[model samples]
Target: MDFASLMTKEISKAKPSDTKDKKETGSNNKYQRRADVEAARIAAYNAEQEKLQREREEKAALKRKHEEDELERRREREEKKRKLAEESRKKREAEEEAAERQRRKRLGLPELPPRASEEGTPVPEEEDIDDEELIKKLRELNEPATLFAETHKARLKRYRKLVKRSLTPQLSNGPIPTTLELVPEKDMKIPAKIPKDIDPESRKFLFRQLASYFTMLLEEWAIALAKRDTSVKESFSGRQAFNAMVQSRDNMRPLFKKFETGDIDHTVLEAIVEIVHCAQERRYVDANDGYLRLSIGKAAWPIGVTMVGIHERSAREKLHESDNKAHIMSDEVTRKYLQSIKRCLSFAQVRWPPDDLLQLMG
Candidate 1:
């Protein structure tokens, strides 16, 4: 073979290999470009997510700030309202004091002394009694525990005066002044039992008499309550008591109607008799307790029944007491009547705030 021909063959083989290498290089460049594009897309997506997260955090922070601001504004408004109310109350009290003083001056009465604590010297801390303790002491002395529009300081001062008055007896032969005068209760008898064979007209007349008697008793109770002092006679407390009494009188109308019709149950009749008798005797505490029994009933005790084991099943029924009063409120009509009676008792309690007279005697 010629030398030139052999050189040509080698060159041709080299040419094919070079072309193949160029194609592979182009493919690698294409793959690298695709990879770069994918990485850029992922970075953009991450940046968008980060931006959204930041925006959400900013909104949450702003919302919290708004709520905090609103709460602070509400507190400020309430505080302002309280301050205004306090100012108004003080102004009213001052005006009332001035008017009272002017009235006293016009009457040519001696100038009222300043309040104990209002004098140049403050009351000794040691002498300051808790309001509850002061109320209890006042009750023990048979004095009214509280008066309408009376402050704790005034109450304490009054209590001290009462204590001093009691401890120091007057050497002069003058009777001690008392705010409350005991009024004797008028005598009244409740029938032991309603006659089972009584005619409807007789029953109606009897119930009407009983209702009139009950009303009279309540009226007497109010008169006694208002005998405390001039201030008490016109006080809101006294008004409340009178209003409660009026409501109670209204409540008893339906009950008396039932009694007249002979539709009242025996338990109800017994309860009414007991309640009226207690009121008549001024055993208000007992009367209130009786009313509670009539209203709620004695079906279940304040103490709940204990669960018995299977072995003690026979003793389960024995655990509770058998009571006729349990079935007193058998029907809805009876329940309504009792509920009304309960309100009447509440009125009586308010009118004559029960004293522990029985306990004291025992």
Candidate 2:
């Protein structure tokens, strides 16, 4: 009985103590679970934040790449355009150079050599003749005069008729027939014999004498013209006189020949008088001395015998004085006079006396 009672009391005390230890252990486990839960929540929040940051970085990188791509495309387009423009310019230049070469070939022009120094250096090439040089050469050839005479002889005859109409009075008798006639090439006679004895000096003398005689005849014609028309004394202009004289084939022909030979003779004086008379008739010369009178017959008579150059002191002086007198007239008158004189001189410079004596005299 005693042993069984003691064992039961000890067992009951041990049970109570074991129950208390179990309760304390359970409380400590609860605390540990709560702490673990809080830690897990914090880790999840941090992971979410890191994910968002990564997405943001990736988006930024994509945007930057797009901008770079756009810039690259723009740069590529500009480069292409520049290249195309350069190519076009080069092609145009090549075409222009080819065209120029073709034009030169067509014109039979030689290719120019390149200059050693490109700056300001002319290419070595043949040049075309200048216009002035061409004109001078043509004048030297005297082809223009010959052609003009051949083509315009009828016109010259018409001009002569007009001069006669203006300068001559209506006579009781009808108009006189012209002594001169244009001989056709078919009718022209060839010389039967050549004069072997005639030296150059003698030929020149004879030609000069012939010219003088022609001039003398022209002077007589001018005097006759002046006497026939009283209107020449009434109204006179230098330009009108010059024009009238120029219009007459008979009066102008001798002067034209003299001018061609660079000879001013009595005939030249008569021509000048005719010019003055015509001018006076036109009322261009308003000077006090009755329109600057010049005697063609008197001035030219000495040239026939003197065997001197036609452009002697007397003729030159008279011409100069007459020209000076003409200058004082109206501007229109002066201009016409100068133009007429130029035309006459030009004609004379190229005209030649005929080879035949009769033709030369006419």
Candidate that would win on TM-score:
1
Steric collisions counted per model: 0, 18
- lDDT accuracy of residue 310 in candidate 1: 55
- Scanning candidate 2 in windows of ten residues, the lowest lDDT window is 171-180
Q: What C-alpha lDDT, on a 0 to 100 scale, does residue 52 get in candidate 2?
A: 100
Give Cα-based local distance difference scores for all models: 0.67, 0.47
TM-score against native, each model = 0.34, 0.26
- Residue pairs with backbone atoms closer than 3 Å in model 1 (clashes): none
Per-residue lDDT for 145-206 in model 1, tens only? 99999988889889989988987733321111212122223434556456779786655555
lDDT of 2 by residue, 1-362 (tens): 69899999889989988999998998787656767889999999999999999999999999999999999999999999999999998799778878878888899998644326446554234533344554454455443322344433333344445546657633211021222222232332222222557675643443433334333333444554566456654566644654565455343444334433545543333444444333223222221122233211122223345435766554545533433343324354333433444333323322432233332211
